[model samples]
Target: MTRTAAIIGGGVIGGGWAARFLLNGWDVKICDPDPEAQRKIGEVLANARRSLPGLSDVALPEEGTLSFHADLSEAVAGATWIQESVPERLELKHKVFAQIQAACAPEAVIGSSTSGFKPSELQQGAARPAQIVVAHPFNPVYLLPLVELVTAEQEVAERAAQILTGIGMLPLFLRKEIDAHVADRLLEAVWREALWLVKDGIATTEEIDNAIRYGFGLRWAQMGLFETYRIAGGEAGMKHFMAQFGPALKWPWTKLTDVPDFTDELVDLIAGQSDEQSGAHTIRELERIRDTNLVAILRALKGQGWGAGALLTDHDKRVRAATALAARAVDGVTPGEPILTQARAVPLDWTDYNGHMNEARYLDAFSMATDRFMEFIGCDADYIAAGGSYFTAETHIQYVDEVHAGARIEVKTQMLLGAGKKLQLFHWMYAGERLLATAEHFLLHVSLETRRPSEPGPEVAEGLRLVAEAQADMPYPEGAGRTIRRPG
Candidate 1:
């Protein structure tokens, strides 16, 4: 089904939520009091268009339409999910919740994107408060994988977790509702110690940050603090480390529990040090730097299969292909029509052993492009998820030319055969006017759950027939009878 999400508040975080959902192919309706909400969200969406595509190796699910509504009630009326990203004030949340409850369906999940507030506190004075859950996603919500889901009602939390998981986010369930959830609580502890270090002249702001990031941060990236320290114990593990360091807990070395006085001197000193370290960059420049670093770090962690590694694996899994021959998945083609995808330069990660784009990635890229073609013909998630999909059964690939790394290429797909149980497709990969590769594929419609040959659903079959009918008059490939090229 094409899910619909209503995003209330069109600021950075809210815009991020909209992009995440919309890029994942959910229809989005945004409502905010500010008249400039559309402009602000547009800017965010532009940046997201570039960033979100690269985050996943797979071609993104077809993006859903975006709508801006001035009326909050209208926005929530038909939305399946209501993501409240209003300002973090309790009163503001309560106010929005009241309106959302009045307008939204009772079964719809109401997600509050609050970083520090408990769901219980946010749900106060609500008519059907049990529907609300804290789905606190990290900053740059479109890119970050972690979303802390907390709710006193386990059902609500579970539902939210399932929904977020479907869209490719790691939802960590909180055992109990705390002020800042799990991630932020760890961050708060570090922040408190950082302030004390700065105040006591033990370390400057930048120095303490560097000490943590350059040292433990590297370990924390792959394995968390406890797990990393457990390895440090040399087979004794966490228990041994705790026993050895337990006595150090008595030292008055940390003012962790105590709050730092935010005096002007302290603020100025911290600000000056931060400025010296990194504040020279403009916000846009800083964002670009952050995105680049995130990409590189996540790429390095891909082998770890922990944290970002799992995420990268999931993203890559979405992009699939057959052995040596590039597999092409086709849908929505009238029996004789064609579908096309304009290619771009291969990203840095797609290159391989020869420093040129890898053979496997050509198939990967073609598969992604084919998915977008399916989406164009209405063979989207709901269509495939409902027990019907076109699986490639046979393929022949001819590499006519080589495309170097970073070279822009394009693909054109034509429907060659359409029968009751099988379909044949031909894809031509081109670099400008030169044909670089030609892929001939035979696909079978199958039940996703059963893994057995099956007829397409009524809607999918009808769309396929329409596309096939248009291409019925076209000629087959010239090399149709040649031996299939085995994958290298």
Candidate 2:
């Protein structure tokens, strides 16, 4: 069945929610009263289009078209899920829900992106409370995977969970309807502590952020608070850690439940502090930095299969490999038969002469094949980063047939010669087994730090020797065996 999502409100959060659904291939309908809503949503979509693909391990799901509606009733008419991200006003929420109820299907779930409002409070006296649930997501919803779900109805909660899980999110069902939900309550605790730190002149805003990010945040990356403390508890465990630190709770340290007075002076001071912390960069630059850091952190977690790892893993499942190389391993293939690399599509930027793939793209495709070949020989990034790099010394190319833009091409690499210090590689590009181009090259191992020719480490050498021995009986391309060329 085709899935569709309706988002009410075109604010930052609404736009983000729309992006999340749209990128996951859900058709989105947004209703907002703001005159500039379309422009604002478009801008958000532009950024999302660029960043979402990078966050995805595979190509994104089919993108959904975004439509705007002036009428709330019109927007939710046929949506599978209705997300209301209106301004956090009780009366406004009530009005929207009343209108939404009239338009949305009885089976479709209605979710509010309300940060602090409980479902009980929002659904007070409504004709149908079970259909309405809190689907509160953090800011920058397109990147963050956490969504707090508050609902009394098991069916509604389960349905919401299914939708959220489908889109690669961690939807935690709150056992009870709390004032601020789980994540926000934790955030409130941190916010209060941050305010106290600034009010007491103990640290600047940046200092507090640095203190958390550099210290505890790094620990939290792999292990949450309880887990970290459990480790600190040593062999004794959580009981010991709690017993040792529990006494600190008795001290006059914090007003955790107390809300700070929203005085003008205090607001000004905090605003000034925020400006001081952020004045150096524009919003776009800040977003770029945030996305880059998120990508790095998520990529790191991909290895550990932690917090954001689930999303990355889900992305990998949906990603279709452009080439067949990833489908199977070349582990024991005899050397004479070409080792098939993955199928690849010509990128939009690689088109040139005669509206076909530029001659250089064939080389690029061969280069990727070389990387896979290196990985097969156990010469991965860590090895290269640790003072070892491969230097291509020679190349011969024959463009037998033209490949146009968007065409899928495959490469088959054959080893001409594999010996200590030098290995000759020959690659052929094919459009479904029809030869399109051929490249023959020679590569030498080099010490990256010294940039000088060097023999690969024994482990790498042994691995290559195994591959070479296996391929020994295979016939090489007629002109495959060639002299190793030296780079100038």
Candidate 3:
């Protein structure tokens, strides 16, 4: 069954929420009075379509439908998730919640995007107080995965977390709701100090930002604060670091409790400095730059399988598993046919200076297909762990056409030969009906214990026999067993 999400207000954050849900295959409904809501969400969706799918190796689910509704009831009708992103006002929120509860289902999750308001406050006059939860997400919500879920109800939190995780978000559940959730509180502290610094003429806005992006910001990106500080402690760890820095905490270095008055002069000074720092680019341009930089950082973290990157790696596995299940549901791996192995968009990093997928990535795609094929024949991770797996003895790739970033590609594998101790396959890669490349791989089953070629296990041998026998009568693939030769 398809899930539906109703976005209460279609501003930047709400639009981002819509894009995130829509891209993740959830139908979206927008309930906003603003006439520009459609255009605004369209731009956000454009950016999402360009960036979000590239985050995963497998293609994302087909984008869900989007529609606009003039009435709250119409929008909330049949919506499983309703996100409220109106301006932060308690009275206004209460009114919206009453209207939402009247129209939305009792079990539908009502997520408030208020940065500072607690769920309790939002649920004050609600018919179903348990349904209202604070699911505050960061800006550029389509790209950022963190969603602060504040709710006292365990059931509500679990349901929200499960839904958010399905859409590739990390829900930080806070049982005890505070005025400002965890991340914003940390940001507010830094904001206050930065304000004081500017007010005191100690550092300009640009200078303060420079201090972060060029210094501890990088460390915080991957390791975070305590771990970074623990590393700073050297061989002794957190205890040593705390002992050294503990005294300094009382030395009047920070004005944590004090705030600078928000005078017009101060506002002008900061805004002027910010304009001087980044006046050249439009907000959209800045957003794109931020997104690109974030993608690079996230991809790097994914490679290391640490921090947020680890989350991304796990999400990829989930996507792959879901794809496999869907494929199996459609047709059990039938014999005498080319098995659909890989279907995904070419990630941004796969391209090189030529602005097309680089040479090595072709082999990477084919290798992924090979792995999928191995799994189909019962030679999976567990099988390999039990000391038997396939090792490529030889591979030949023919690049017929160029593939660029964001192109949806599919790989289909034909089991040319699958016999005892040997597996031979031909893979054809395509973008729709356009054949882009072909790869032939000859692999031998090997014993992981001794790292030598060995006879196939019973389960695997039976699988190989089924496919090999079924496909034995199929015509030989074109260009099979060919060697590199001069054009003729």
- Write the residue-wise lDDT of candidate 1 on 363-477 in tens digits: 8767765665555545678888666777877877777777785687888777666555566667888888988887777777788899998876666666566767767687766
Q: Considering lDDT, where higher is better, how would the candidates rank from best to worst?
A: 3, 2, 1
lDDT top scorer:
3
Clashes of 2: 6
For residues 165-186, what per-residue lDDT tens digits would candidate 2 score against the true structure?
9987889899999899988888
C-alpha lDDT values of all predictions: 0.75, 0.79, 0.85
* Residue 435 lDDT (model 2): 85
lDDT of 1: 0.75
How far residue 141's Cα lies from its native spot in candidate 1, in Å, is: 0.2
User: Candidate 3 versus the native: TM-score?
Assistant: 0.57
What is the per-residue lDDT of model 3 for residues 1-488, given as tens digits with 9 covering 90 to 100? 79999999999999999999999999999999999889988999999899898889998999899999999999999999999999998999999999999999999999999999988889997899999999999989999999999999998889999999999999998869899999999999999999999999999998898788646685677546765555455555445556677566666889974455555575456445544655565555554555556667877878988766787888888887777523431134565678788999898888899999998999999999998888777787788999999999889999999999899999988887776787888999999999999999989999999999999788788767766665666777898779522112
- Those runs of model 1 whose alpha carbons end farther than 4 Å from true positions after fitting are 257-488
**Candidate with the larger lDDT of 1 and 2:** 2
